[model samples]
Target: MSISARRHTRMATVAIAGAAAVALALTGCAGPAEKPADGEPVEITFQSWVPNIDRAVDAFNAAHDDIHVTLETITAGPDGGYATMLSAVQAGNPADVVQLGYDAIPDFLINDALEDITPYVSDAKDLFVPWQWQTGVFGDKVYAIPQASGPLGQFYRADIFEELGIDYPKTWDEFYEAAKVIRASDPDRYIAAFAFNQAPWMIGLAQQGGANWFVPENDSWKVSIDGPETAQVAEFWQKLIDEDLVKIEADFSSEWNADIQNGDVVTWISGSWADAILRGTAPETSGKWAVGAMPQWKAGENVSATWAGGSANAVLKGSKHPEQAAEFAVWLNSHTDSVSILTEIGAGWPSIVDTAAIASLQDAPEVFEFYGGQDIWDVFAESDKAVDTSWSWPPLSSTLFASLTDNVKAAVDAGTPLVDAYAKTQADMVAALTERGISVD
Candidate 1:
């Protein structure tokens, strides 16, 4: 494919088809690279943050005599990588391939930063989980290859629950009752932490309750940060906060780490990727912790959601070799050699549809032994299948996250109802999108 075929003359079709007039063009508009001389490998660059990912890249280079990919390590997105990638895009120089979170795909599309690689990678769609594949598709165009997923699950201190004679709650109502029991047992401990500062965590909770914060309608976005389902989720947590049944703490912080290590916090409702985080942060609590499916909205129901941990690999807009880059990306995430490496290194759950084929995942005794010898992958597999395929992300997700975090933190410090934060964010989001010339209803 030529560079122009990959480049977008304007913003992506999905987010700005008829909303307003917006223009974005690659400055150089150079022609595609000439065919490589015989026996000369095609050289391309890949930007990513996954730990130990170079093992997979090295394997790719060794297996393919026609292509060689150079890996460039960068800070994780939201910690300067996204800014760096955008700066490179605007400067007419960017890596051939870049890693992006699922929620951030729409943002990249809106900025015209991703290449349309459907011509080269469309056939590989069947290799990944259905919903995960959809994350890279918009308006019949495939912009990326699904790399990994983060289906929701619950991580809890099993020893503490057993000591208190409490079983894992199966439903939200039962979870609330269990919270009361845990709170009554000791004032220093709570069933969980509010973590109001983490917008992605709250978004997953709302999604589990069947909330769609953003919807595409008539080529415009229907913003609904204050939808009823989201309000219900907010109100439920607000009750827990009002009654002092949950602690107010920022997750992954020193205070939160202490709580986890000391058993002051009993459970965490988060993505499957949190397994690595929990083990790395609180190694002392290895056998005491276990994983389970998220508490359902109703008894006997099975539904789940994903967090921001899931990511995809996209060919950047101005790549000189889009076809080779796309081919390398597809193989990096799907080939047995690469998938095994990713599994062993704990790169989020592999996005492959048939995860059972990965030898590392099939017999992870060490992972099982860490969580009291229970097979935690079974829980994650079930959670991954239960995720709602109808859910989607929206453009300007950074703004959405920022607005929600600011409002929720203000509500927490002011002793006001938490649902009020969502209400305020709804108005803030609509106005912000409108000011950017993007239609919002």
Candidate 2:
């Protein structure tokens, strides 16, 4: 597959007029009423890091004549773009709607930057999956609506697996055995790959059985880093690294891409959104890749679930047009037409409960081809169904990840005692949380 050939499916852009026309046609009689308030055209600002925001804003502007949205693109860099949002909100000019990741919600809520949409949720709560809808909740109030979700899975080079005469592994034991086989066959090549310097994989492992590092206890946060389940998961990964069965990279970068394309790394354990990165980076490897369920804990560990990594849309407290913004968010997340538009633009799978969107995605041959003929939608849907809704994070999730990653590297690379390293990480987390007046008991 050439680079040009591997590009996303080119679909005609739906004009604003076309969207209005379609909305009118769906309503059966006439278009929606004119602007309720004839005041200045309410310009709602939307903030996000994804490139698909442009398309969403365009569709939104075309569908409604009353409110115009101005999208502000934030770079998804090392800072995670939270600093930008924080500064803006502190300056009393925050965006009307912001795309908040699961881990970032708690911090935003703590700062009172998010609005409690519990009232609005009752209007369209039935339209989304329960877990998706609940991801943004801080207490009894909904703060965000799930816009997209990416359940963890194993992305592998199918062609390489076929060449080695091996099947995709279904369990962790089998996965490790397969890794050993790949290592023995070609000492320089690895069956699975990851950036050990990152905590994303660990988060996936912890969520394998609905386990989380933090849990709510009497309105205070409690740590579970040393739980039996977490220890077991850590030991499993540590053993794999020690045995040289998996390739450990420093980070996700161009060098990692080179390793993947050159067959030095044949598989990756990550969320479904990784498909976009894979397809974009290794276009020549397009029909050779496939996706499968994340290797489970033992055999039937709580139905093989993992944590999801995606963003949710929320209306900020400062928005003047809260009602309209809330309505737009519901439409973006639940309406089939909006979801189709998002899919066509290569955003991601919608969080809506509408099975028709899943069906339509499954039937798209271009998407399947990009995934090495794998029924990726089926894999995602299955993972979505089995997702562990208990997974959550604190507002300082980025800091926590940095601390844990540093500790893990110290133990794995510097030969430090794992227990001591984890203790240091726990202390660091406690201090950070304490500084914010959050209890880490």
Could you say which candidate leads in lDDT? 1
Worst 10 residues of 2 by lDDT: 7-16
Instruction: Choose the strongest candidate by TM-score.
Output: 1
Clashing pairs in 2: 16-62, 107-395
Name model 2 segments beyond 4 Å from true.
1-40, 119-121, 300-302, 305-309, 344-348, 358-360, 417-421
Cα lDDT tens digits for candidate 1, 1-441: 222222221224547553334554434222477577888999999999887889999999999999989999998755468878877877878888998998888777777778889999878978987767777877668888988888889999999889989889999998999999999998799999999889999999998999988766555677788889999999999999999999999998899999999989999988777777788888888788888899998889999988874889998877889999999999999997799788767677789987777887888776777799998888988888888766667777788888898999999999998889999999998987777667776
Pairs clashing within candidate 1: none
In candidate 1, residue 142 scores what lDDT? 89
RMSD of 1: 4.1
lDDT of 2 by residue, 89-191 (tens): 6665567778877666665655556666678666787787766666675434667888887677788888888888888888888888888888887767988
Query: What TM-score, over all chains together, does every model reach?
Result: 0.92, 0.85
* lDDT at residue 51 of model 1 (Cα atoms): 77
